[model samples]
Target chain A: MGEFELIRRFFDRGDRAADGVVKGIGDDCAVLAPTPGWQWLVSTDMLVEGRHFLSTVDPERLGHKALAVNLSDLAACGARPRAFFLALALPRADAKFLEGFARGLFALADAHGIALAGGDTTAGPLNVCITVMGEAPQGQVLLRSGARAGDELWVSGTLGDARLALEVFRGTHSLPGDQFVQVRRAMELPQPRLALGQALRGIASSAIDVSDGLGGDLGHVLKASGVGAEVYFNALPRSAILAGQDLMLQQQCLLAGGDDYELVFTAAPEHHEAVKDAGARTGTRVTRVGRIRTEPGLDVLDSDGAPMAVLLASFDHFKS
Target chain B: MGEFELIRRFFDRGDRAADGVVKGIGDDCAVLAPTPGWQWLVSTDMLVEGRHFLSTVDPERLGHKALAVNLSDLAACGARPRAFFLALALPRADAKFLEGFARGLFALADAHGIALAGGDTTAGPLNVCITVMGEAPQGQVLLRSGARAGDELWVSGTLGDARLALEVFRGTHSLPGDQFVQVRRAMELPQPRLALGQALRGIASSAIDVSDGLGGDLGHVLKASGVGAEVYFNALPRSAILAGQDLMLQQQCLLAGGDDYELVFTAAPEHHEAVKDAGARTGTRVTRVGRIRTEPGLDVLDSDGAPMAVLLASFDHFKS
Candidate 1:
């Protein structure tokens, strides 16, 4: 199939009635009418085969993960998903692959009420780059620089399951068939905490998505806000499969392994009940994992309140 | 170096003072404050190494072309340049390549006053995907669907030189050293017609950028507007080197040559002088090339006003 025909068949859905999308899909440029008082949020992510996912990954799940990663950025900023543009480079026009990929992609977009506004497609080695555009009210959008001393840090959902799945894939760890399936799902299909982020907009002082594991991503919030943190190592939440592992393995996965897609946020001590209320409203499990500190460096503390030393460096695509 | 350090050193510029940028580069998502009552325009383009340019092409030109192609889409919609997001995948982090690339990319961005907001970087085969965000007032943006049956077709600047340059590179044709340099520049560095597009917004009924050859790109406008057109074949503008070629070669290059990055648009006959004034105001060379008809297909007429037929198929990435 030709490029235009392929796009028309698979990607261009003509029934988009998205609120801010004045024009979608068929134009030289997609036109968006922004909500009057809202600030627009933009983010882009590029996923490559082998580097980002296994060659054997299901096309549907690949599609889901591509948009999921980009949406995670918006959720971290307390932005409501509005629309997205995809620029895809493929090896060929595989009909079966396109069908399953579109199905998985649009399913998540529909669930979030976000529209596939426009994109570009070409023949090349397989690559998926998604740029998501969203909106939040002015002065209400969350940022990394909002944290300060005396704020309590929190996280939504569990972490490390995705990394555990990766370890199994790498032959460094193994799990029973059913348990492997569970962790694999966590790695393949991540649900963005859009509602939890929106709910915590005013209550939380700062927020970030845990894409590069908790340690490295939290370091971003600290470096940006110029504040230190004290993470309670034992308080870090995990899946049952991970909790069953040894302490060192658990710390390795939970602290420095990548692709968690959970929100790490901070709020003042007085708003502890408010943060809990937000978690309840969004049906998310919010855990108090750390607190903002006046000092200038991170402290990962054990149950004894003493810092434990480990070189828990996160995954760096180039240097790793 | 790590991914964060790579981004900070190359892509992240801390001095962005663009009008509507609330936050840039460091946040989870770049925040943009849109101009009230103006509609936002978005477009994306992906350029792969072998497909889009020669592997030996300069890295600086590669960077410029990457963003330039996306900006062309916004120009076609008559939107003012605002900001862009880049998603880059590289085989390795070569510091020299990045420095030249950033220099060229930022030069054009500075010329257009667009900010490099936020994006992703990963290790893979080289790929550059850019998403540009622009703006035009509501109801003022030109669209392909706006052309009328009696409108006169127009094109800005020149066409076909880029293809001539490609022919030389492919060993299909040859040119003198000086002529080759001129045409090669056309292929390597295309200037998007931002000012002319904005100038023609109220005057032109429809507009499109000539990327996939004039014939195919014009087909999109005709298909969208539900109209046909008659091209004065001999009147199609060409560079001096292209004009010196034989008739058949000239016809192939002028009709179906891709990567011209020029604007093809339509305006009512009553606004001919106004169109000229817009061209003059923007310092662009605008030429009247054809007229839109109520009929359902495109017709290329010779100087004798007879339909002369030769296969002039435009470039399609997959099929070609």
Candidate 2:
């Protein structure tokens, strides 16, 4: 099949009306009619081999992860995803790879009511860049700069499942067949909490997506909002995959390993109930892992309320 | 310098007032204010190493040409250039390369009042993909499907200089330093006719940018508009660099060699005066090249009015 036909057949299955995308894939350009009283939010991220992902990962999962990360960004901003454009660079024109990738991408896109709008395909080393467009009501878009000193910090879903899954894939951990599958799925296909984000729009004071682990991502929110956070180590969400891991190793992995793609946000003390209620409506778990403080740096506390000693700093793209 | 500092010091020199761009580069995500009376025009193209470009071309020129080609797409649709986002895949963190590239990109962005909105950078083989956004009044976008049988065809600027420059670079032809410089510059920075595109909104029946050579691009218009064209060889614009080239080679290059980002359009005969006036205002020369015909394929005639046969087809990204 030709390139155009392949795209249409695999990536064009979704309810366009639900997404507010007047036009979807298969045109020189996609046309969008804006939602009334809403502002569009746009962000793009690219993943390259040896930088963002390993070559051994399933192609289908790679596709899902690429779009999921972008959606996570929209989730952080409390935007309802509308559509996306994908620019893919491949080493060769492999029909199988394209098929699986498009299938994976469209699965998530359809679930979230996002249409694949437009994209470019070219010959190059394997890379994927996804640009997601979303919408939020006027002045209701949450940012990373509204957190206050007394605000409570929260996270959707578990923190270190993806990192633990990575360890399993790296051969450092072993599990039974079913357990292995579950952990691997978590690493491969993370579900971005889009509905929860939209619900948290007015309630959350500041927000960011956990792409580069909790420590690094929260640092971005703190830096933007000009406040510090005190995370309770005992309150962190962990999976059964790390049940018997060494304490220091588990803590380090939870703090430093990246690729979680969950929403990390803050809410005022008075709005905590509302925030929790919002998550309940979306059927996603929300954990109160930390609190915003007047101090200007991150602090991790043990169960007894003593500050944990600092070790490694947050992940730096350039340095990493 | 850090990523944030590098961005501020380099890619932030363009005008931020371009239509539809409420917020530009340096933000978490760009905020675009959609035009009330316009339909947004968007297109993306990717250029990869050992494929779209050679290793020896100046880094600055690569940056300029990347954005210029997308601008050409806007020109084809009679849309005014607005804002663009870039996705770059680099092999390493080379500060010097980034500096040169950002400098060249901002140079054109500032001149055309286009804002650098947002982009992603990743580690990989050198690849650059630019997504450009433009705007045209509602229902006024000059698509490739509006040509009529009696419309006159026109072209902006000369063609084949960039192809000739490529030939020179490959050491297949030797020219004087001045001619070489001119041709090389043409290859590096073919200007997009933004003013002509805006002016052609109401006048041109159909239009397309001549990036895949005049033959292929014009063929697209013909296919889309379900019409034919008749070319007058004597009216074709030729640069001084082609003054003494072999007649057959010169004609072949002009028709089939790609990378000429000039506007090729068809308009009603009565709009001739307006076209000339638009050219004068924009300080870019425009000339009549051919006419739309009732036949279903292209026909080329020599200066003496006899049929001329095409010896070579135009460039194709996947095939060539």
**Top-scoring candidate (lDDT):** 1
Q: After superposition, how far is residue B229 of candidate 2 from its true place, in Å?
A: 1.8
Candidate whose TM-score is highest: 1
lDDT of 2 at A295: 91
What TM-score describes the B chain of model 2? 0.95
lDDT of 2 by residue, B1-320 (tens): 54545556666654446566665664356667766666667777788887678888788998899989889888877787777888887777788999888878888877888888888776678889888878788778887888899999999989889888888887988889999899889889989888888888888988888877898789888987889998897788879777568877688668987888898999999999988888888887899999999899998888887779875477754455
Clash count (model 1, backbone only): 0
TM-score of chain A of 1: 0.99
lDDT of 1 by residue, B204-291 (tens): 9999999989998999999999999999998899998999999888888888999999999999999999999999998999999999
User: How do the residues A1-320 of candidate 2 rate in per-residue lDDT, one tens digit apiece?
Assistant: 44445455656564345455554553345556776567777788888887777888788888888999899878888888987888888877788888888878888987898877777777678888888888888788877778899999898887776777777777987678888788778778999989998999889987888877788778878887889999998888777666557787678667776788788899999998998899899998999999999999999999998999855355555555
- What lDDT does each candidate get? 0.92, 0.80
Residue B185, candidate 2: C-alpha displacement in angstroms: 0.5
Say which docking band candidate 1 falls in: high
Best by DockQ: 1
